[model samples]
Target: MTPKKEQMTMKQMMSRRAVVRVPSGPASIETIDVPVVEPGPGELRVKIGAAAINPVDLGVAGGLFHQLALVDQPDYTGLGWDFAGTVEATGPGVELPGGTRVAGFIDGFDRDHGSHAEHLLVPAANVAVVPDGLDLVEAATVPLNATAAAQLVDLLGAPPNDARRLLVTGAAGAVGAYVAALAKDRSWQVTGMARAADEQFVRGLGVDFTTDLGQAWDAVADAGALQEDAFRAVREGGRFIGMQPAARLPEERGIAVEVVFARPDGALLARLLARVATGELPARVHAVAPLDEVACAYQAMAQGSIRGRIVLVP
Candidate 1:
């Protein structure tokens, strides 16, 4: 039988998941059977179509977050953050019916289950309907990165004056590209710092492109996780926002340092997904692999410098 048929034939009492018990690294990843949990009140059970592999998932699989004491699951740690799927069942007080296409993410590292599975139980308020134009594979890449960018820009706020020069490192990256596009609404003159080859893509977002990280910007959105390096580019008393919540940079030289911890906001995601559907935002997918090939996909992502996300289909 094909994987899809096999999935349908599996008993409804159990689900398949990618997990790590010791988290030694990608090599330690294991696919195992887990109980199929029913949704509680105000919750929904999603039959996952696609889940995106992210740096955070790598951290979970490699024991980085475990070393930091962020994960405390006794048996195993779940992998994956963002996913796009169809609602299979809804609990009491939920309005979405079965078979509705949706995309969303679950935040935090201390969990026994995640989106990289045959099924997921998520809060109804944490997901938004997948729009008409966007496919599940591409939609899976949006929730975590785009939400983080929106939250990071929220911390940056509006520039104090008209001379609002802002530098965004990793402009070609998932989060950085969203930041570059969204920051313009706050009246900031956004300059994306990326490789010379990324000039066209960065400029396509209606932001200036720079191959170098020049100094003395009014604010610096460090989506690249440059930490100290990106912090130094900010002018005195300027704002410095970072995506790394685990390794937050200390404030210095009158620069305000803040970090974004992406949280699920279904309503906010609806707006962002609409932009993607309209081509106002980009949905980048590097590759798609079956759920059984998760370990290989994680290995490929670990090699570094991948431009787009690798999505896993179940």
Candidate 2:
């Protein structure tokens, strides 16, 4: 009799992964079969349930990173950042039992594989247990953007008594909304700059909302990647935090320019996920697509104006 799938070992399995050989655009995406990898010490092999398609993924597929010379791969470049899954196998020093629901993201541009796969091997310390009620698709959207927002706020620090006014550009975006909401805890008089249509959503975060990029703010969080336009909105001697790490804007008018580059932190992600489950943080999904339809999904996202993430289910 033939062995069932559940009876097979990792070494006996082949997994499908999405990759970009040339990275011309979404049409260049292709899936290839590869041997399943076993988790090493302090690692866990997760059976991915969902992975979110972000702007970064689009950039990877569209050759943005390649143009910057940030990618170096002989075969193909893996495309994906965050995922939610169940622990299928554990390596030495991992206490999490098999079947534990978890969510996390890998940080970097150059890689042979990423979360957009049937199976992934990640450090146990880089993943957090997903809350009981949160769906894996929703959990997949939290790790990368939220971590980036939190880290951006860390650079913003506490607002000074004399300079408490802050403007967050792209307030309707994943990173901006989180920064708009979290910056309030640090005593910032927050304002959100978004489109007129996004007023309701931006205002719902308990911050002031405006469509205009007003000048003379204490700080400007350029989550929109407005670059020089957003930087110009900050007052003299104020702070300006940006999302683009590779293309940082120059400082002028004595404004402090800093950029956020998100890193993986399992313990911090646990707290963030708990907050997401409790409605303290926001999780939005634009649509869901099967792994086979990744090319279509990437094409849709590349058209721009997407409010929520498109999740890929394997």
The prediction achieving the highest lDDT against the true structure is 1
- Can you list the residue pairs that collide in candidate 2? none
User: Runs in model 2 with CA error above 4 Å?
Assistant: 1-12
- TM-score, per-candidate, Cα-based: 0.96, 0.96
Candidate 2 C-alpha RMSD relative to the actual structure: 1.9
Give candidate 1 regions above 4 Å deviation.
1-10
Residue range 1-314, candidate 2, lDDT tens digits: 34665556544598989999999999999988899878999999999999999999988998889888889999999989999999999999999999999999998998989888888999999999999999999999999998888888988899889999999999999888999998988899999999999999999999999999989999999998888888888899999888865378888889898888999999989988999999988999999999998899899989989898999998
Per-residue lDDT tens digits for candidate 1, residues 186-214, read 88999999998889999999999998889
